[model samples]
Target: MLVSLARVASESGWVRPIVDGSDVLEIAGGRHPVVEKALAASGEGPFVPNDLSLDGQRRLLILTGPNMAGKSTAMRQAALITVLAQAGSFVPAARARIGVVDRLFTRVGAADDLARGQSTFMVEMAECARILNQATPRSLLVLDEVGRGTSTFDGLALAWAIAEQIHDVVTARTLFATHYHELCDLAAEKPRALNLTMSVSEVDGRVVFLRKIVPGAASRSYGIQVARLAGLPDAVLRRAREILANLEAQEPADHRHKQLPLFEAHKSAVEEALGQLDLSRMTPLEALNWLADQQKKLR
Candidate 1:
């Protein structure tokens, strides 16, 4: 087994990762070893190499990208590299610096354990509970599409809460890949949260997956294009497009508003006060008075 490991490492041009004691992770030009081997056997184009970095200030990566854009592959490779390094094997990367992880947790794919009488969402939540309860500051977690088995609002809410708990309480290094673009908001408020997405481009109205990780969130999921690629009937696809448009049109322009209770009543006075406030020109005293007035109105 050792010989085979060494041989594959040499053949694949894998590198010995630096086992640093610091709470940091750095990988440069990382590629999925299995995918690389498959491409090599088929004489296809080389895999695209992408870089990843996480540290004390930026420990959680919220990865958002379109379906079939290699989000899962990239996240899995990170965990795999850690496994290889701890097992005394070279990793598939140009360079790597890995910290010692006490525990490795992954919630990647959906599977129901029928014998246990648990549904897919039940299994997902069970695993998630374990991760939340067991993972520590030195643990590594790769969670892909948590809370995806439920309604959109419920799923988004659960995803948001899980992310916050991991960031604020567990402080574990995590690679979270999701179709929920709204989760990207965590990066704005949390110092240790960062956003990443797989690069994609359009060529003559067709979607192309670049399979390269880049900074920032993806603008859209491109689900319709993926369904089209899956050979869905033209009529069905057209209907789906229309329904998607109508749903999106009903969504609030601000993602934050979506979190508000669906039946919450809007206050015209509060709205008017917000619109009338000119923060740039207001003095501190004036600002205080305005806030007091608004507070009184609410009462």
Candidate 2:
């Protein structure tokens, strides 16, 4: 547990107290202590230098950026720094002024716990609930990918509500990282709540992560490029693009929205048509054209 705690400390940096109405968790230039140390023993250039700080007027920091852009690492590093500083050790950062937190809670990512038979998402909610129930004003909570198990609206609703609860009710310092860029709007009302983002660059169709943290939410998540990076097949990528296009054209999910019923009706019509099709009488080429025409009509 100590080893794990130390690693967490190295990955997350410190959360300093609010000074002059500006709350900033100061992080001076430092490599990922654990990650860099290992790479150095094998002789490699270290990660870049960066600084980040948040004030009381900004009690919460929402992080956004493309996958593998070091958003997760930076979030973890900030949290880790807070833990180490509170534990009375010299932080991995060159300088930091962390508020004294009574407890440090984190829900970083969902992973299968086969022994417990819980789905990855279920485990995520369970950890979040623990933080909500137990965290105090002096606590520091780090959450990553909250509400990832469910549909878009469901996930966004849950994430929004949880952040509100932590800020309005629990009043704990929070670092929330999510793919839902929409949540950045919360900063408008929650002055104590702010958005932070990681930097990214493209070179020869490849992504390079700057690993630096800056103020404000990101505008894009670049899911397709990340999917390509994961080795998604060409056909699958094409299909994903089509689905994304359709979703973008669709209305937002809300109780007042009537588009969902329209979509369902369209799906039902397609199913009926398929059921009634004379497959034995049609040529393969004819069948393919028929399906394509049907799909086009839905759009």
Candidate 3:
């Protein structure tokens, strides 16, 4: 098992990882052993390696990028490297170090349990609940494409709350691969969180995957472009691009913009007032006051 990891960093590098004392998990130039061999056998281009750095403080990594951009691969490699490092084996990295992990938990793609009468989203939530309940600070979690099987707002809200719980309460080391670009705001709100994205390029109106993971958030998902690559009809692709432009104009790119808690009191008061209001019974003063409160909350 420890003999794994190559293309990016071979096991022959022999950088034995320290797992007992340090409050960190760092893997430089890590790659999937299976993927490396598969790519080599297929005579494909070189495998792209990525680096990971996590510690007790900065433990949550919010990974965002387009579809088929290697986000899942990067998360899986990080987990594999951690497992090997803790097993007292020379890791497949230029260098590797980690605090001993008590348990490793992962929730990948959505799945359905027919025998259990659980839908895909239900099964996903069940697994997530278990991980959240059992994982500790010393544990490592790899979550991929969470909140993807449900409606946009529901999934986004669930993902947002789940991320907050892990960052504040669970405090587990995590590599979360998601398509939610707004989650990059986590890096702003939480001191222990950071953002990562897969690199890509736009050349001659086509998208190319660089397969490299780097710091920072991606601006958008290239689903339309990918569908074109997948051989969707040219007319369909053109219409889809038009619809995408319309949708983008419908809402701000950063839909869930981050704002400070400076208006907490005003916000609470406004919400409470709105919840109790009877529009038909409102006086002139009441209308004026409500408008003023709404303006204050906005600011």
User: Residue-wise lDDT of candidate 2 within 1-299, one digit each (tens)?
Assistant: 66765565555552232222223456666345666567567886666656766556667888888887777777777776666665655566666766566788999776868699888878888898999999987777889989898887778878988988888988777888988887787786576788888888879866777777777788878788889989999999989989987877663654327434323323367777898999999999999999899989999
For candidate 3, what is the total of clashing residue pairs? Answer: 0
How many clashes show up per model? 0, 24, 0
lDDT of 2: 0.74
> What is the per-residue lDDT of model 3 for residues 115-207, given as tens digits with 9 covering 90 to 100?
989999999999899989999998999999789889877787788878989999999999998887867887877889999999999999778
Model 1 spans with C-alpha error above 4 angstroms? 253-258, 261-299
Candidate 1 has a TM-score of 0.87
Candidate 1, residues 100-151: lDDT per residue as tens digits?
Answer: 8898999978899999899999999999999999999999999999989999
What ranges in model 3 sit over 4 Å off?
A: 1-14, 253-299
**Candidate 1 weakest lDDT stretch, 10 residues:** 260-269
Model 3 lDDT, residue 230, Cα: 88
Sort by TM-score, top down from the best: 1, 3, 2
